[model samples]
Target: MKFRKKVDKVLGTSLAIIMGVMVINVLWQVFTRFVMGAPSSFTDELARYLMIWVGVLGAAYISGKRMHVAIDLLPSRLNKEGQTKLKTFVNWVIIIFCLAAFVIGGLRLVYITFTLRQSSPALQIPLAVVYSVIPVSGILIIYYKLSDIINKEL
Candidate 1:
């Protein structure tokens, strides 16, 4: 539980920082384009990449809080025991999906991007750096879900 709380704090803080930077980047981009009459070259790409991080990390944060979107109709109708079982099953499903889709697939994507030396045109940074968030968020989600199971939060 302490570890979970720490993870939540770190993820939340990191997301907040990334969002702040993204907002500033966008504002700079606008200021440059309109006020300076010459748009900064890297701002757009930086903002886009920061957005990707914010979105992926935000999803993990939401999962940790058990605040992700869900249809509660079935669970609402279930008895306590039934709801517990259903929630556990759903948690496992989420874990499996994140492992397969985010961790495995994301690693492959990151590897390929690194191998090819793909980069954003404007920022000239490796694309793999941006894509790395996929696996990181996947692991975070997996950790949160496993914690849920272990803590019997279902």
Candidate 2:
């Protein structure tokens, strides 16, 4: 539980920092393009990469908070016990989906890019590194799901 709390804190801080960097990067890009009349090629690509990282990591943080988007019409209509059961079912579904699609699929993609030595066009950063966020987020979601189920918070 302490580890989970630490992970949540670190991730939250990281996401916040990434968001700040992204905003500044975008502002710099706009300023350069409009006023300086020359845009930085690296800034656009960097911002895009940062956005991807932030989005994926942020999703993991959101998972820990149980804030992912879902239609709650059925659960809302149900009683407390029913809602708890529904939440558990939904969490299991999400866990399975993340494991299969994100963890497995993302690892495969990361491997492929790594083997090929693929890099981003503008930033020249390894594609595998950029894509590694997928599995990380998936694992985080899995952790949160397990925690929720174990604690019976759902």
Top-lDDT structure, candidate number: 1
lDDT of 2 by residue, 34-153 (tens): 999999889989998999999899999998988878888899899999999989998899999999989999999999999999999998989999999999999999999999999897
- In candidate 1, position 152 carries an lDDT of 98
Against the hidden true structure, what lDDT does model 1 obtain? 0.95
Backbone clashes for every candidate come to 0, 0
Per-residue C-alpha lDDT of model 1 across residues 1-35, encoded as one tens digit per residue: 99899999999999989988988899999999999
Query: Runs in model 2 with CA error above 4 Å?
Result: none
Per-candidate Cα lDDT values, in order, are 0.95, 0.93
Candidate 2 similarity to native, TM-score: 0.93
Per-residue error (Å), model 2, residue 46: 0.9
Clashing pairs for predicted structure model 2, backbone only: none
Pairs clashing within candidate 1: none
